[model samples]
Target: MVGAFHGHAHNRRCQLDWHPMYIDGTGHMEGEGCEHVFSASNKLARSTRHASVFHRHQTIEEHFAFWDTDKYAALSNFLRNHYREALTSIHTLTAELSVYPRLEWELAREADNQALTTIPVGDLNQISAALSQARIRVDSAYAKLQNAEALTAHVEMQLQVEERWAIGDDTYNKYKQETSLCRYCVALDELECLVVMHLFELSKLSLSGTGYKLRQQIGKALQRRSEAIQNALSCYNVQAAALDPPRPSLS
Candidate 1:
C-alpha cells in the first residue's frame, strides 16, 4: 500500500498531502484525494457494527414489554443516587488509603509523606477525619439501601395481598371490603417515613461529618431500622393471618 501510494505520489501532484494511516493494525497511505476511500471504509465499518437488527417500538409500554422484568430490578431512583454517592466516597477513600502504599509509604515512613507527594497525605488526625467523613457517607448510604429494601418488601406484600383479594371468591371479597381497619396500612406508612427520612437525612448532610460518633453508628441505625421493619412485618403478618391465608406462591 505504501509503495503504491509513493509511486502514485510521484506523478499525481494534484496538491495532495500524504500521511500514514493505521487500519486494523495495518499501515496504509492516505492523502487528500484518498478521502473517498477512507469515507467508504468508515461506512463499511459502521454498517458492520450496526448489522444486527432490533425491534422498533410504537409506545413506552411496548418498550417496557420488550425489556425483561429483571431490568426493573435495578435500584430505584432514591436508592440509585445514594448508592452511587456511597460508591464514589468509597472509591475516593480507597484511593486515599492506597496512596501511601502505592507511592512507597513504607520506604518513606519517617519522612514527611504528605509534603513529598502532590496529592495531600494527611497526618494521623487528618486520616481519622477523612475516615469519619467516609463512615458518614457509608452510613447514610446503608440506611437508604435498608429503607429501599423495606419499602420494596412492603410494596410486594401489598401487591400480593391485592392479587389474592382480587382472585378470592365472593365471600372473601366481601370480607376484604368490610375489613379496612388493617394494621398493615399503618405499617406501610411507617415504611414510607423510613424512605422519606433517608431522603431528608441526605439533604441535611454536608461535606463534613454529621458530628455524630462513627463507631458502629451504621450498625446501630440499621438495628433500630430493622426493628421498625420487623414490627411492621409482624403487624402485616397478623393481617395476613386474619385473611383467608395468602395463596401459595408460584415457583
Candidate 2:
C-alpha cells in the first residue's frame, strides 16, 4: 500500500500538466522520460510516517486568530464616540484647565460673551446662576476625568493597545505618541464638555433646551466606555486563552 501510495503520488506529480491515463501495472506511464515502479496497494500502515513526503503551507495568520483587532477597533471607536467634540474642546479647554484647574473660568468667559452677544440686555443673573452650576459640574466632571485617566493609563499600558491603534500613524513611535495624545485629549474633552454642557443647559434654558444634549450623552457614556473596555478585554482574554502554552501537570 505504501509503495502504491508513492507510485500514485509520483504519477500525479508527473501528470500535473497533462491528461492522466493509466493501465494495469504493466503499461507505460504518460509524459516524457517519466517511469516509476510501485506495489499495488494504495493504503499506508500506521507504523510508518507519511508526512516526511508531503509538504504543506504555513502563514502568520495560521498561528494567530485576529479577534483582538476588533476588540481594539470597537473600543477605540467607543472612545471616539465618547468625545465627539474633542477637537473644539481641546482648543478651548487646555489653557483654561492649565491656568484655572477647571472649566469655571471658560464658562465665565462665555457668560461675559453672552451678555455682549444678546441684542437686548440679558439676565446677568441667569448667567451668574449658570456659572455657579458650571462650578459644581466642573467638579463632577473632573471626578469622572480621574476615572477616565486611570482607564486611559491602563489601556495605554497594555501590550498591543498602541500597536493595534497605530490609528493611522506612519510608524510605531508615531503610533505611541499619537494614540496617547489623541486619547488623552479626547478624555479631556469628554471631561470639559461635561461642564460646558451643564453651563449651556443652565444658561440657555430659556433659549435652547436641547442644545447641550451631546454633553449629557458624554457624561452618561462613562458607564458605556467602561463597559466597552471590559467587553474588549473579555474578547482579548478569550483569544489569549486559546493560545496559552500547555502547563506541566503535578507529578
Candidate 3:
C-alpha cells in the first residue's frame, strides 16, 4: 500500500506540468522539465512514507507521523475519535457496578435479623406455613440479585469486545470473520475468557459481600417465622393434655 501511494504521488507530480504540455501538443522544455521531474519524485517518496505509517504496529510513532502529514490527518483523527468513544464506554460500565454493593449490604443485614428470631405462641401449623412463605421470598430475592449481576457482567464483556475492536485491523477482521480462528481470534478468545472469569469474580464478590448480606436478612426473617411456629406447636400440645377427659375409672 505504501509503495502504491508513493508511486501515485510521484505520478501526480510528474503529470502536473506535463499534462498541459501534452494537451497543448508541445514537447517538454529542458530546464523546467528537469526541475518538475525532481520535485515530483520527492513528493512521491513522501506520500509513500505517509501511507506506510498506517501499516506499522508502532502506533505512537505512526501517530506522530500522521499528525505531521497533512494529507493523512483525516485518517488519524478518525482512529483517535473512535478510541475515545471506547474509553467512554469503559467508564460508564465501571460507574454502573459501583451501585451494586450498597444494595447487597442492606439485604445481608435483614437476613441476619431473620435468622435470630424467637418462636411465637399460636397455631403451630399456621406459624410453620408463614415461615415457609418467608423462606420462599428470601430465595426469590437472591435469585433476582444473581440475575442482575449476570446481566451487568454481560454488558461489561460487550464493552470490552468493542474496545478490542477499536484497536486495529486485526481486531476488526477477527470480529468480521467470526470463525476463522486466526491469531486475532485466538487473542480475542483469550480476552473473552478472561472477561468471563472477571464476571464470575464480580458475581462472587457481590453475592458474598452484598447479596449475601441481603440473603442473611432474609434468612433471619424466615428463622423468626419458624420460631413462632414452634411456640404455637408447644401451646397446642399443652392444651391437648389439659383437655383430656378424666379417664373413666380405669378398670
| lDDT of prediction 3 | 0.51
Residues 1-251 of candidate 2: C-alpha lDDT, one tens digit per residue: 12333445553334222332322232223333212211211122211222233321122232223334654669878678646656655654454336444365446545544544554336998778767766865886797698677656654665346554454555756655555555444544554555454555445344544446645654455546555545544444443333324122211
Off by over 4 Å in 1: 1-177, 198-207, 212-219, 244-251
Q: Which ten residues in a row have the lowest lDDT in candidate 1?
A: 14-23
* Most lDDT-accurate candidate: 3
Query: Between prediction 1 and prediction 3, which has the larger lDDT?
Result: 3
Could you list the CA RMSD of all candidates, in the order they appear?
Answer: 30.6, 37.9, 36.7
Question: In candidate 1, what are the lDDT values of residues 128-207, reduced to their tens digit?
Answer: 77677567657856976886676666656645754433457897777774584354456557766765655554543442
TM for every model, in the order presented, reads 0.22, 0.18, 0.20
lDDT of each: 0.49, 0.46, 0.51
**How accurate locally is residue 203 in candidate 2, as Cα lDDT from 0 to 100?**
52
Between prediction 2 and prediction 3, the one with superior lDDT is 3
Candidate 2: where is the Cα deviation over 4 Å? Answer: 1-122, 157-251
Clashes of each: 0, 1, 17
